[model samples]
Target: MTARTRIAAVAVALSLGVGVSACSTTTADDGPLVVVTTNILGDVVERVVGDQARVVTLMPPGADPHSFEISPKEAALILDADVVVSNGLGLEEGLERHVDAARADGVPVVAAGELVEPLEYTAGDAAGTLDPHFWTDPQRMVDVVDGLEREFAVAIDGIDADELAQTSAAYRSELLELDAEMTSAFAAVPAERRALVTNHHVFGYLADRFDFRVIGAVIPSGTTLAAPSASDLDDLTTAIEEAGVATIFADSSQPDRLVQVLADEADIDVDVVALFTESLSAPGEGAETYLEMMRSNQRLISTGLSP
Candidate 1:
């Protein structure tokens, strides 16, 4: 090759290399650093942030929000995050300390559930105590998305405000559609048959939204961290019998054997319907996203409750 041709080719290669480097640097710097406590909230953050941020979820897929514990490395990740998102309101019992530590380290810890209008459980002796499972209702999750957007804007400066606003608006519309679909889907069940029996008391918001009654739970508390006594199980079984609840909705993340034992002892022919409650399913599972999880649950509940 001529010397001129070699020089020209070298210049072209250098130009291409510089362009690729510039693009890579821009992408790395433009994406905001985000961290979520659970996979469920991670999915929601993904929907909101899209490609504008780098999101790290502390909990693995299908990990129980109430009982899943994180390691020191994960805890360090939380502490160093730009914004740490969590369901809050005690839903993440195992990671609450790490979240608090994150806050102590000056990381912004956003509690998505605190943005929602919380509902209280009125079953048995525990009346008027707030239920932490707000994501059960899609409308409440809309508020959570709003809170997350605000947090993202504050944490991710230099981002296009208009773009973020537009993204949030679009996500809000999707959430509204989900809310309407769930309302219509749940309405098909007969009113009396709308009673929900579950392994834990995690459906207060869902029951409130769809006019279903949460008859009883095997755990008898909003959180699975709380153990149920034999007497508590007896009382719940009695309530289930009295209410004639045909289905006990068990969390897919939790063991269903306890509920099976209860069902066998009751001998009431009640079916145990497994639903995604606290955490979402693994990718490719039907209930991987929050919207899909809610719809799947709506279908299961409505189908199980229908006459």
Candidate 2:
């Protein structure tokens, strides 16, 4: 080959080598290690992080956030994480200690619910406390997305600020759209029929957002671990009758025998609707993601509330 041709061939090879190296570098620096406490929050984190983080969810699909128990190995994984995201306001009752340990280890932990304004509930006799089930409100979840983006930026060092900002904007827009959809869906129901009775105090955020009153819960506490006394059930039955609540929503993960008993004792025509409240559904099932879960619950609410 001529000397000029040889020089050109070497230049081409060098250019291709540089391109391959750049691609490899980009791939290697793509994201950081992220640990999410539950599958529900994990879905939101995945959307915000996109392809920019290695997100690991501790809670398995279909696991109940209220009662989920993690192994020692899982705790270790959380301790080693760059960032740990939790639903916060007390959703993961069983995993709180693990999260506390992770924080003590100096791992950055973000509570998505803390970003949004929380709702406080006071049973008839107990002291008031903050409710942790915030994902029920789509707009509040937008605040969670914002918190997730900020946490992601801190967790994933060297992230392009422009890319992060753009992602946050896009996700916020989607959340606003979801909020509008939910508003329209619930608006079709008469205002008097907007009350909800659930297996537990899981819909406080939802009720607050959509102007629906949470008339009663079969279980009076936010977590299912708290059992309602017979008097609690009696009070709830009274409230259900007074509010004319037509449906009692139960968690699909919890046994419905108690809810059924409450329904029978209430002596009212209250239908029980099982919903994916604290956990995402298994793959191929509806409510597998945060958005899907909200949509599914909205449908159930609309159907139940319709005359």
Candidate 3:
């Protein structure tokens, strides 16, 4: 072979080698990725993981978890994730397939719901079904954090165990403080007025934890996607009147139209108060973090119900 031909071939090989090297460098620098389905769990995972992994949160702020869909790019990220975090027990109705695909590919999934003691809905369409909105109870959130700490240690390869432990412990401390704060704040509401009426059955855990009663919901279901029948509204109105519930809480992400309509239809006066029940709000809004969300809701519930 001629020297010129050999030189040309060598140049082509060098170019291919450089391209492959660039790809490898990008992958290494990108590090491990953790894909979280819901924004609520996203905040928790980010706090626990700190700077150890890149967290790609699919659900945006103030978005409904039950019906939020992901783009193709976001779905692709799930399949590539080293570990995926989700609020399981049928909470994320939209991203189940992507989560399933990631699990099928042998990626680790940390379902926060599965970690805590689950409660079933007592009266809604989801009655007898496991509740996924466990974050309403800070004690349950502490349980989730505990599970996440253990899972992150094993699932995230090459993570600094000491750093992970320190971060998890710090966050867990915050959760316990939150629990204490909630307990104290909720004590002010009069026992007779300790009934909760919401747009949906999203506060069962809160009701259980704080010694409040779960009156019927406008939608009469655990999911926001469920619409209320006229009879459902009638039943909830009767519940509100009988329980002497002066205020009904509605999810900020959802329209308060139904809540208002219900209030109008009620024989007794009912005030509709908005709360960050399911999703977090944008930065500078009331709820930007998990702790902030819970704290904001705690204050809202206490003030909205207390005499």
The candidate that wins on lDDT is: 3
Error of 3 at 279 (Å): 0.6
lDDT for each residue of candidate 1 in 1-307, tens digit (9 for 90 to 100):
6432333333222111100000001113345677787777788887787778777876666667777776677777777677888887777777789899889888887888778888777874456777888888888889888988887888876767777788888989999999999898987888989888887788888888889887787776776656566566777778888888888888887777677667765768888889988777776989878888988988888888888
In terms of lDDT, model 3 sits at: 0.81
Best by TM-score: 3
Shift of residue 282 alpha carbon in model 3, Å: 0.5
The residue-by-residue lDDT of candidate 2 on 1-307, one tens digit each, is: 6432333333222112000000001112335778888888877777777667677887776766777777777778788888888877787877899899889889998988779888788663323888888888998888888877876777777777678778778878988988999999999999999998887788888888899987877767777666665566667778888888888888887766666666666678988889999878877889888888889999999999889
lDDT of 3 by residue, 29-117 (tens): 36788888888888898888888888877777787788778777777888888999998889988789889988999989988899999
Q: Candidate 2: TM-score? A: 0.87
Screening candidate 2 with a backbone cut-off below 3 angstroms (N, C-alpha, C), the clashing residue pairs are none
Clashes of each: 0, 0, 0
Error of 1 at 33 (Å): 1.1
Per-model TM values vs. the true structure: 0.87, 0.87, 0.90
Model 1 residue pairs with clashes: none
